[model samples]
Structures are given as structure tokens and as C-alpha cells.
Target chain A: MDSKLTTTHPMVTADSQSVSSQEEIVLSVQHVKKKIGKKWIIKDVTFEVKAGEIFGFLGPNGAGKTTTIRMLVNLIRPTEGTINICGYDVTKQPEKALAYVGSIVENPEMYPYLTGWENLEHFARMQPGVDEKRIQEVTEIVRLDERIHDKVSKYSLGMRQRLGIAQALLGRPKLLILDEPTNGLDPKGIRDMRIFIRELASQGMAVFVSSHLLSEIQLLCDRVAIVGRGSVIAVGGVTELVEDTQHLVIWELEPQAQGEQILQSIPSIQVLDLESSNLDNDTAASLRPHSIITATPEEYISTTIATLVQAGIQIHNVRKLSPTLEQLFLGVTEGEFIE
Target chain B: MNSIWPLVQNETIKIIKKKRFYVVLLVLLVLVPMFTYAQMRQAQENRTKFGEDWRVELQQAITDNQNSLGSDRVPEEWKKYRRVFVQQMQYYLENDVNPNEPGGVTFTREFLDNSSSLFIPLLIMTIASDLVSAERTGGTIKMLLTRPIRRWKVLLSKLITLTMFVSLIVVSTFIISYVISGAAFGYSGFNIPVFTGFQPGDTGTDMSSVHAIAQWQFILMQMGLIWFVGLTVGLLAFMVSVLVRSTAASIVIMMAALIAGTILTNMAASWSTAKYLFMVNLGLTNYLSGSPAPIEGMTLPFSLGVLAVWALASVIVSFAVFTKRDVLN
Candidate 1:
């Protein structure tokens, strides 16, 4: 927990220093618009991932996440915009721009006839001076050694995904772009990928991960840009966006026979819910004082608890519950929803 | 350059390892012998049907025809056989020549010239038609394009590999046809004379004198001309492969063009410019064979220039289209 405190401090100083140094803008897309026939896939969308950040491109299905990632990797040209990566404009100098980026789009279109190692070797050879040692490192990093020599046609969906990641990691790319890297992964595999991504970020490799998995974004991404229907709706640190509203105060407590009556009697404070489902009577007796209240910070939440005790409700526990990312995501995106 | 080499290697591997490529080679293997055997059989039948010694038969026919003609002699149709017969008798009397000179390189070369309407052209088409279009079907096109290399370089490498294989196939055909036919007809005549430089107006009689060009030199010249046609068709098929998304479509399109060209050359004698089409000029050894030009006055240079134009056009169109076209879904 304390590690989070230290990472934030260093990131702040490094961001400021990088801003002055002009080294932070590893990728910049300014007003990128892509229209396929009559429909726009990515409209005036823009963001940048610095040299060493796990920047999550968070969105729902059909939210232009894949389109944005594709444009960044120069797989598709935008109808109107300039995308610059590693000091080269992607359109003007695509080969050079692409040289700095390693990407995995929709599904990894690997050669099915080739073995997993052969697939990596082929892509590895695509990037010059990328030695066999690097190949081994990437294969090990993605934990594909046991099956690296097996033909890709024999690979399961999850194994193929890992192999795709191994290929992306082969060149030690300055910018690694992954589209839903965990889309088909099991729980353990997702955990491993999250750790691996964090390790890459720790090693100063910036990653652009586009996914609808908001919890993973919150857990893994240092920063995220949220998009919907070809436009970015929100962008910032997860905590900053989620904790912007301080009114929600969640607390837990012990059972009191008159717990509901006591909290309801308090003015301008509403006690939201109580559950006896996961509790014994003794446990319920200890947690029957549970409540959630919405109020200004200046309006003490303790006042509701004090009132409850005075009204003959036994109180054993009370503490604020941190807002889950799901609630925060709902709040941020739902605000954009039309009635 | 390093980035593209891997792509090139993979492309080369894909082409060389494909069963279709080897299948084409195997078909050529079975076919060359079949055609050579069939040609030898037909020549044997002609020998038996006419006479054991074709020269004696030719002299007898010419003497009888002359006696029959008595007053009005040497009609146009008789002129051809008479001239050939007279030459055969003169050759027999002067050098003790025999018309049946035991089939050899000379016989096979002649056999190839007649059989080329279908054999060599089909062999060339089999390899070239599906080179790129097959990649599209295998879903390897997407894998190839997404590599960090430029699109043109990818297509360029494929073209290079195709060119190399085309050369290999052409050279292989010449050697195999020679070796197989040579075994039955022993390779003693390394320096046999063949005719060349037969321009249309050089001889008014249309039956020009056979000046001596060596058998190997003649084969080399014919190979050069066939290679030109093969390269043109290969490049054209490449263009078709680029334009058409399916292997079957590409092969059918090229095959139709080839067949149509042969048919038109046979049937369209009145259409002088038909000689200028790429297909008509594919029979490069026509001058040696002394067949009338498919078009009345079309010369070698004119037909070559036309084929060159089509070849160049296909090259330009393929590169331009392939480099820019959006990939398959």
C-alpha cells in the first residue's frame, strides 16, 4: 500500500521534468478523424502516452478503441489528423514511426504453420540487431517457454494471446500497443499479464492498452483516456476522476435492534442499506449499525453515528468505504448518456 | 533492409514449400515424357506409312508427278512437295543422306515447337497464375503486410522469388526435354545445322534455303524467345493475381487469355494485328519452323515490341495497384 505513495511522487516530478525536456511526448495524435464512407469511426480523438506509462485506452464495444489503436500503429490512415510517434509524423514517415511501435490488434494474425518460437524469430528478425537473447527474454517474459517450440496451429486461444504479447515484447519497443490483451485470458492469466505489463512499465516502456475491462484499467493503468462513439469523453488518473465527488460516505457497524429506526430519524442524513445474509446473529449484532450517508465534508458523518448511539442502537463499527472503480466509471460515463 | 529480409525469407519458404508448386513440377515431369513419346510415335507412324526410306519415296513421287505433268508443270501445291522431294533426292545423291536420320536433339527440338501450343505455355501458367493470389486465400497476406516492412518491398520480394523460379522452370524444361529425348535418340549430333535469319522478303519463293545455325545455338535462341513470352505471361499473371482476389480467378483469366490468343492466331488469319497480341508472339520458334506469320506481314521485332509493351504495362499496373490497394478484410 505504501508503495503506491512512492510511485505517485516520482511520477509527478518525472512528468514535470519530462515536460520541460520535451521527451514525454512519445506519441501525440492531434484531432484524428477517420470516416469510413458515411460513418465516422474515430472523430477528432486525441491523446498521448509518455515514455513510461501504462496508458489505458478504455471504452466499450464499438467505441473506436480498436480504430484508435490501429491508427496509432499506422495500420490504417486517419481521414484527417497527424499522429507523431518517436519524433516522426506517422503519415509522413510511417516506416520510421512504425519502427518504434510494436502492436497487436483484434487478433494476432500469426503464421499458423510456424512454431511459436519461429513466429517470434520471424518478427524478431524484422527488427534489426534484435538478438536471439532478446527473443529468449521475451518468450520467458510471456511465460511461453514450455510451448514455444510447438506449432502455432496447436496453440490454444490463451497461448496464442501470450505468444502475441511475446512477439510485441521482442524488440524492446519504446511503445507497445495492445488491444484487449486480456480479452480471452483466464483469471490467473489476466493476473500474470497485469504483472508483466507493470514490469514493462517499470522498465520505462510505455504501453497503450485498449480494453473495456475497467477494473483492469483501474488496477494496472497509471492513466486512462475514456472514449465512446469516436470521441474521448474523459481522461485522467483513475483516482482523480473517481473520487472527485466526496459526498458518498459508506460505513459499517454492529447490530442494534432499532438500527434502522435510529438512522432514519436523523435529518438530512439517509441510512441506505443493511444486510443479514452473510452474518450470524452475533455477527449481525456486531454489524447492525451499518449505514451510508451523503453530505458535505464539513457536515460530519460521525454525527449520524453519534445520533444512532444516542437513539439506543449498539454500534461496533463505522468507517468510510472507498468508491469502487465500477461506481466511478458509471458516474463518469453515465453523465454523458442522453435521456 | 534487415526488416524486409525476414519477410522475404518467409515468402520464399511459403512458395517453395507449397504442395501446389511441387505438383506443378511433377505434372511437368510426367508431361515432357508424354509429349516426347507421343511425338516419337507419330514420327514412327509417318515413317512406316510412307516408306522405310522417305528420300526414295519423295524421288519416286516427283518423277511420277513430272511425267504426269508432261506439258504444264510445277503447280503451286506440287511446287512445295516437289521442291522438298528434289532437295531430298539431291541430298541423298550428293551426301548419301537418309530422311530418317534416327531421332535426336533435332527431333525433340522440332517436337517441342509443335507441342508448345499447349505444353510449355501451360507449364509457365501453372506456376505464375497462383503466386500471389494463393497467399490471399491462405490468409497469409494480412500477416505479410502487418510486418514492419513496406508493402512494395513485400511484393517486390515475391516478384523476385517468382522470377527466379520462372528461370528455373524454363531452364529445367530445356534440360529435361533434351536429356530424356536424347537418351532414346543418342546425343551424337552436337553440331547439327539449323536455319536462322529468314526474313520474309529475303526469298520470294517463301521456301528459303536452310542456312546452317548449330542445334544448341538454335535451342538457345528459341529459349530466349520463349523466356520472353514466359516472362510476359508471368508478369501478366502477376498483375491478374494482384487485381483478382482468388487463385482460381487469376489462373482462369490468364489461361483464357493464352487460349484465346492461340485460337485467334489460328482462326484470325485476316486480322493482321492479331500477330501483335502477346499470345500470338508466344510461339517464338515460328520463324525457324517457317510457318506463315499468324498475321500476313507481322515481323519478329513488331510482335516482340507489342509483347514488351504488355509486359511493361502489367509490371507498372501491378506495382501501382498492389502498393496502394487496401488489404482484404
Candidate 2:
């Protein structure tokens, strides 16, 4: 595959300091800052998307993901910073720079009066080299051939989503930015979108997808950037992001208060607060009320269990809880309390 | 700039598909016949009064205006208007040409002159005010601005599209008024001699510059001036559309301004400075018919200058704001 060539040749890159693979960087945002009115909406953000890679941009609400995407497409200007798409600056040379980019910001807002095919044709005319053949190819790529002739006002949300992607791909851009790519899709449609995105990446297109679906990002993206409060807090490989967190094990015991107190008193044991930690709502609620969490390694947990038993604690359950991307996201965006 | 035509085509298709153009045509379709019927009734009333000869009708109208000019009950403004009408009628009678012969060309010329200030600009504003604001309201402006082109070029295309449709609306108004009215008034006056160039208030209806031209030629110049008025109003509406986010609000604002212009033209004669206002200068066809200027010094070139400046300023503001403003939403 064309993507494999990118991974095979590992080269040390310039100052953006991304992964070791030698694929050309398709998008680079350096110290981008945007001030809206008197408030700073995007304080300082920086990252890069390489060719043939699926980059996930993770952030909670008001994290400036949509703003950055608007800047990438030159719909909004960055107050202070440079965003280069392909090789040209998006703000300074939007015609030359945006030529290599396709994006859908908040919604795929096409003219409702126009048909899906007409919308594609309208966008195709703006770029330099797009033609009728390319419009048809994109329509086929998004699997909207059956409904492409219908007016967009009649399209369902999922159909409109597909049409949005079709128009985004009309220019055959090197970089494709999708905000909440799987937002309005059913389970089957979501699976198909995942495969479709993978196919685009395999053809050496850099796909930047901003989503709140952590599991989707974990399964699909090669690398990810987690944004918090208008800045890039962390950027790394998906698996590595999950691996870098502190390990933890859950224990259920009678007189859980005594057991947790005794464990906290022990010099070698570290107790974690399950209630106020807010690691994740589901993860915290899944544990019993009397259960306690400890970050002690398994080999050393035996001593802690013996000591808790001696303190009149009845051991009901003990199991190692693996770290998931959801826990990692909650911890990173909130404060990374696990560390 | 080179690719402006395709963008214009896109805009045109969007408007047509949205049925905005059709609505304008529908309005003309419904209104022209009523006006034509009214004109037919007036012609019938005059026929019974003067019996079959247009010359006799012309003679009687001149006598009536001359009598009104001498009456003390006529306001000074009304007296001035009748005085000019009587002088112009005397010249037409002396030259043996009937100015208001009942026909299709005469109907069109009358309709255009009367509608220039309000009816025609109102139609042009419907399309222009929705040009940019409708896209914003629909949230499609993000898609429009994201294309791989300069922002100014996109706006220029929209301006060009507005100009094209403005011309279409004006030309169609003339055609619709002529064709529909011709059915009732008889289509027989394209080559009839028409008197013009009798400058009101200059040398008391000076017949020295009063020359006779064909009625069709007079109608062509009338259409040309009306088209400029429509284009100027369209540019102002386009500017409002760019500055405002809601299409409905833009339309309302432009409509209010146009209605105010019509009102001001009627009562702003003493304001003096009102002469510089584009609305007061909207009677450009009046220069062709030798009607008194709304405010004393508003000649053809002066009104054209005022409209030109308004159109140019609107263009500058529209482009500056459109290109520089951020798409915050």
C-alpha cells in the first residue's frame, strides 16, 4: 500500500518533532492563538498531521477544535500563529494552500435548494483542476450515488453527512479534516465510515478527525492530539497514550473504610479515591460502594492484602483493572490525577 | 476575477431554484394587468369627452391645464406643475404632434417613469437583500467561503450576479408593461412624434430646446435611466445583505429606506441638502420628460453622480467587511 511506504522509511523530522516515520507533513499548526472579542478562545495550539496517517483531535466542549478547523480552511483567521497546509500558509495564501485541503466544520452546510450533485459541482468549480469526473468519483466514494440527484433539503442527516464528505473529497485534497465524523451515523454506518476513512488514509491522505468518541479514536487513529482549554495538552500514538498512565487495581472488602485507611497508612501502598477522582463516570460508578482502588503492583499487593486482613478486613473481591482510553481521556483533560 | 462567471452561474441557479426570480416575475404578472386596465379606463373616459380625435383631446387637455394655472385655489407647487404642462401642451399642439396618444409604447414609458422610485427598486431589493444574508441564515456561508478562492472574488461574483438580475428585472418590467397594456391600449404608437427637452423652471418651459423624437426612442432612454436606478438600489441592498445576518431583516431595512426615499422626494423640496440623497434623485426619468426636479438643482448629471457615489461606497464597505470579518459561528 502507499501508506506502507511512508512507515518503512523512518526519518528524523524537523522541529514539530512528530513520529519517526518519514511521510511528509501535510498540516502543521505552530503556536496558533485566536482571541475573540476580549476573550482568548484558542490560547496556544500546535500539532502536525503527516501524510498517510489518521490523526484524532480529542477535546471536550469549548476546547477550540472547531475554531482550529475553521482556521485550517481559512474561514477564520488565527490571531497569532502560522498554519501551513501542504506548503503554503492558509491565511496568507488560501487559494494555494486550501487547494490541498477539504474540511467540514460544524455541519456540512450545503445549499438546501441544490441537489447533492449540484452542491458538489458548485464546490468543484472553485478549485483549479476539479472536473465533472472528480465530482462523480467523490459521489461514488461516499456511496451517495443513489441519492446524489435529490435536493439536499430532502436528505436525512446521515445522507447529508455522506454528501458533505463527498464534496470535501471533490478536490482530491491531501488533507481531510472532519469534525465529529461519525456524529449522526447508525452503528452500521459508523463501521462503514471507519473503513472508508482507513481506505482514504491507505491512499496517502492525512485524515484529521475531531471526535468525542474515545473508543472510535482508539480503534481508528494512528496518533492523537488531546486538547484542553484551548491548547494541545498531549500528542502521541493511541496505544502509547493509554500505556503512559499509572496502573491501578480494584479491591472489594467488608469494612471498606478500615481497609482503605489501613492501606493508606502503609508505606508501600497508594490508595486512589474512587468518588471524587472522576476518572470516568461509568468507571467510577461500576465499582461497589465498599470497594477501594490501589495503584500498588500485583507482587506487592499481596503484603497489603495480608495487612488489611490482619486489620479485620474481610476480602470479598480483588481484580486488576486495565486502563482504557476513556479513563485516559478523563484523566488527561481534567488533570491527569492518576499521575 | 477570471472565474467569476462560474460563481455567478452558481448564484443564479441557486436563486432560480429557490424560486426568488419566479416570485419577482409573478408579482409583475399580477400587477401589470391591473395597471393596464386602469390606463384603458382613463383612455375610455377621455374618448367620450373629446369624441374620436386625439387632436381634439390634446386641445382640451391643454385648455384645462391652462385654466388650472390661472386659478388662485391651486397651490404654488400645483400651479407650477400645471404651468409647465400647459406650456409643453401648447408646443405639441403648435408642432402638430400628440404627446399622450393611447398606445403600448406610451403605456410602458408612463409605467417606468412612475415606478422608478418605489416599485422597481422594491423588486430589485427582494433579490439583492437575500443574496448574501440567505446563505448566512442557512449556515451555508461556511461552505461558500471555504472554497479555494479569494474572498473578494466570491463577493465580486455575487455583485456581478446582482447586476445581471437587476438588468433582467428592469428590462422585463418594460416588456411586461408594454406587452400586457398593448392588448388594451392598441399597439400603434412606436413611431409617433414625442416632445421632450422642455426643461421645467428654465425660461418658463422653454420651447427653444423642445424637440420632437420618436416615442420608441424616448422609451429606450427611459428604460436605460430606470435600469441605473435599479442597479444602484441593488448595490445598496447587497451591502445591507452582507452586513446583516438575517435575510428577512435585510429586506425590511432596504424596504424602509426605499419607502423613505419616495416620501422624501415628495416633501423634501425645501430641505435643499436632500438633493444629494440617492432616493430624492431617483426621478432620473423626469429629466427625460422635463418634469421639475424634486429639489431645485437636481439635474440628470447631478442625480447620476449621487447614485454613482452611493453605489461605489456600498461596494467598498461590502468588500471590506466581507473579507475581513471572521465567521464566528
Candidate 3:
């Protein structure tokens, strides 16, 4: 773990200026709560998205991620607490606060009847300091120059998403809030979006992306907050959240039923039952018998191996499993549906 | 507020690009010609029947209206209308200016005054009803409201755009009517005198209450007054657009209100409260032509005041509702 940390932490130090400027928080959502009629939709949600970082908001379905995003963009006001964007309270001074913030909530809902250029031109007029050059620059960044003249109704979903991103980038916003930016994209489109988002962060813009794709969040985000039931269950770096404190060791042995009985006799180790009922006859006949053994803090794997060997069990192989994001997410969310 | 100009420009561009304005122009192109042809045929029939004696025709109209006024079964509203018609015929007879002259300017002015009450309002509603509600339906409201500008500014820009298109529709109607009618009726009545400013009680030929204005001045003033009424209709439709989420609903509601107003004005004059309805007073051009009000006691100033209140109240309510309403998907 220390060796892995040494290799990865240097990437953080390479962008030393950005790392130092990370102290400049672009979005601060503190104790935010929203109640619609009789039910509380968001309960005391708090998080900070810093500059030059990709902040992932991971949550299960009905976790209030969109509600929180809507509140930040001033689409819906927070019932309690405050959301500050670039040091301005969203509720009190939305115009000034949201001046430097660009957002795409849910689907990139552009006017389908208008040409892509017309849609961008119309949105550009709404924001101050967005000139023709800025529009061209953003359109180029989104790689929409060739098709910008075409009506948006003719564009594919991927192209529409790109146009949406271009519109959001028009004002050179300090904080870009994209709710499910990669939704409905092919694998290549998703990859391109990932690269584009990283490039935007490299330009010192704080990006707050809310998504339920755990692997995409794991690969794309620098830090993430896992939300469940309208509350932040965990907030930490991606690697930190997935790092396991305890290791799971699997041992394959001859006559697994006898080995399980022998392992159950030891007080320091807990033996896991291998359910053979689910396996087909051909697979069950050809498969090696395996048992999962939990090693206590007081005992070593060698001790368990020695105990298994002394009980007349022939051990064929031993392996240890590293925790993955999928396992970590399941553990954090208790196997609830993320979508 | 300073950013409102670009917003207005953006809105105006959207409206123009949607091709809805061209629909108005196309409707005018088709319908105005048909109406002009019908009017030409009627004028030819009048000439064949009455032998082209302007004085005799004016005297006949005056006598007919006076005969209607003497009827015991005539309703009070029709009586008022007849009285105004008799007075107008008397004015035409005395001034020696033919009211039914087959000329471009005369036909255009009459067509404008006649259409101002219903046709212009319908056209304005077609554009105004979709201003805000269409944005909502198109999902563009999400893109619009997500910007840094205030919500009121967005609604104001729509209002401004609606006003621009309303003006365009009105001017286009006039130009189309004039050009089309000019083909049938020669364009040569620029200097003819028309009488205006006759009050409710005064006879139409009462020179003390009425004054003579050139044909061109009357057309300009009539256009200006009709523009006010068109703007009022647009504002009311804009209010409906803001209140409703569906463009179809907004257009239907405004159209129903307008059609109902005309029906009520014709048949429900006994309901005194109908005088205060916005549609009852939308015929601001009638005042310029010295035509009797749809309801009794609705003077030019009173109608103008009623329309002003309606416009002002619609704008206020629109701003209030739009600024606070949630942009729910």
C-alpha cells in the first residue's frame, strides 16, 4: 500500500501550483436541506469542490444528487442552509454568484429547431463577457465547428451532449456542474467526454460531475463523495475509498469438505462454505475445491497453512484478492441499486 | 438590465427563425387578396344598383339608419350604432367626400379599422401565445434559466420580442391590404379629408366636435391606434403564455377570450360589467374612426384606460409568476 501510494502521490505533486490552489474552493455546499411539501429530499448535504479537480458525486437512485445540483444552480432554492459558488451565496445573490458558473442539468436540452450555432449564439448573449471569439473558442474546444451550422435536431445524442458542453463552457465558468454528462453515450463518446473533462480541469476549472457509473467515476474523478439516502456516506480520494484494511485469502485444497471441517475447528480462522448447488455437473466435476479463510490479526497465513497441512489436507494454491471499486461501492451502499 | 438588449435580440432572432412570422405574412397574402376581391365585387354591385350617385347613396344610408332608429323593437345598442351610422353618412354627404370611394388609401383605411377588432388580435395572439410557453415546451427554458441573467429579464425580453412582432404583423397587414386593394382600387386618395373626434352624444356632422384630417393623417393615426390595441392583445397573450405551460393551451385560452369578447360586445351589452373587459375595449381604432363603442359609456379615454390597466396588470402578474415559479421539467 505504501509503495502504491509513493508511485501515485507524485502525480499530485507534479501539478504543484494546482495542488496549492486547491485551497481555493470553487463550490461550498454546507448543511443544505430541501423539503418538498412533507418529505425531505436532501438532508444536511455538505461537500466542497475545489479548483482544478474533477469532483465526482456518486449516489444510488433517489439519493438526491440531482436535487442538490439543482439547488446549486439556483433552479430550486434550498429549504435550509446555504450553497456558495465562487464565494457568493447562491440563495442570496444568485445572479452574481452564478455569473461564473455554467451548468447542464440532466439532458442537454437545446432548442432542437435552432441550428447549433444559433443555440450557442442565443445562450452566449445571455451571459456577459461572452463574445464571438469566446463562442468560437468554446465551439472549437467541444469539436463542434464542422457541425455547428447544422440544426441541433439533426445532431446525434453524442453531438448534442458536446454542444451542451460547449454552451456551458461559453462563459469560461470557474465551476462547471454537469449532471450525468456521459449519459447515453457510446464507449468512444464516453472516452472522449472523459478526456474533455480532464482537459477542462487541467485549465484550472473545478468540475462537479454527478454520476452513478462507479467505474467511470473511479477512472475519471480525483476525489469522490458516495451519497446514500440523501446523505454523504463517504468522502475521500478514489484510491483511499477503495483501499481495503483487511485482506481476503483464498486457499484451494484437495477434498475441500475435509479442509472446511479442519478450518472450522480452528478458533482463529473462519471458514466460508462453497455452495456447489449452483454449479453445473460438468463444471463441478472439473473444478478445484476452494474455501475462503479469514485470518485473524493474531494469526498469520502461514499458521493457517500449517494447520491445514497438519490436518492431512493437501493445499494446491493460495491467493489474495485486492478490493475493487465495485466491491467497495457495494460495501458502502450495502448493495443497493446505484441507478 | 443592461444585458437585456442581447436577450431581446436573441429572442427576436428565435422568433424570426421559427418561420411563424412568415405564416402571418402568408395568411395575409392569401386572405387579404380574397377579401379585397370580394370588396371590389361588392363595390361594382353598388355602382350598378345605385347608378354611381354619391349624394344619393349617402342620403339613402342615412335614411335607412334613421328608419332603424325609429323602430320600437330595435335594441339600445343597435340604436346607438344606427345613430353613429346616420351621423357618419350626414358627414360624408356634407363634406362631399365619398366614404365608399374605390381608392387604395380609402379601402386600406376602412379595411384596417374593420379588421382591427378581430383579425389583428388573432394574428397578434398567434405570435404572443407561444412566447414563453413554447420555450417551456421546447426544453429551451432549461438552457435559458440556467444562465446568469435574472428571470424577469428573460420574460421582459420575450415581452419586447412579442411587441416587435406585433408591430411587424400590424404594419405588414396594412401594407398588404393597401398593395392588394390598390391593384383593384387605384391609389389616389392621399389628400381626401376625413372627419374624426366625434364624441358619443355629438352628431357625426357636428363640426364643433369633429375635425377634418387628411387621408394620410387618418391612416397614420388609425395605424397608431390599432398598434396600441394589437399590443394590448399581445400582452394579454403573453400573460397567458407565462401562466400556462403549454403553447396550445395559451393560444386557445387567449383566442377563446378574444372571440368571446366580440360575441359579448355584440350580444351582451346589457351586462354593464362587460364594458370593463379588456376585449370589450380592444377596438381602440373605433375611437379614431368615431365609431360607436361596443358598449355604451366607453369613451376613447375610458377604453384606453381599461386597456392600459389590462396591459399593465398582465405584465405585473407575468413578471411575478415567472420570476418565482420553479422550472420543473
Candidate of highest lDDT: 2
**Candidate 1 residues B1-329, lDDT tens each?**
44455666766666664554676678767877877687678667767867677666556655765565454655544444344444444444454544335556776576567645556667767767777787666655654555566777878877777776767767877777777777777775646665555444323324346455667787787777777777888899889998888989998998898899888876676776677678877776776645446666767777788889999998899999887765524
lDDT of 3 at A216: 79
Q: Which runs of model 2 end up more than 4 angstroms from their true locations?
A: A1-22, A246-275, A279-339, B59-74
Question: All candidates' TM-scores?
Answer: 0.74, 0.89, 0.84
Candidate 3 local lDDT, residue B112: 91
Clashing residue pairs in candidate 1 are A253-A287, A254-A286, A254-A287, A254-A288, A254-A289, A255-A285, A255-A287, A255-A288
Query: For candidate 3, lDDT tens digit of each residue in B1-329?
Result: 26688988988888888888988999899998898889989888878878868777778778888988889999877788778778777877887888777788888998898888899999888789898899888877878887887888888888888888988998999899888889889878888888887776634434467888898999998888899999999999999999999999998999899888889878876688899999888788888777777676888889889999999999999999998876657
Q: lDDT for each of the candidates?
A: 0.69, 0.83, 0.80
Write one digit per residue (lDDT tens) for candidate 2, span A255-287.
Answer: 777777787897766787765333556767788
Reference interface contacts recovered per candidate = 0.28, 0.74, 0.68
Question: What DockQ does every candidate get?
Answer: 0.23, 0.67, 0.52
For model 1, residues A173-270, the per-residue Cα lDDT tens digits are 78888889888889988998899899987887888999876667878988878777788766677656655633444444445436655555656655
lDDT of 2 by residue, B1-329 (tens): 25688898888888898899889999999999999988889889988998888889888888888888788898777777778888877787888777777888888889998998889999998899989998899888888888788999999999998999999999899889888988888877889888888788755877678788888899889889989999999999999999999988999888888878888877887899988878888888989888888788888999999999999999999999999999977
Q: Grade the docking of candidate 3.
A: medium
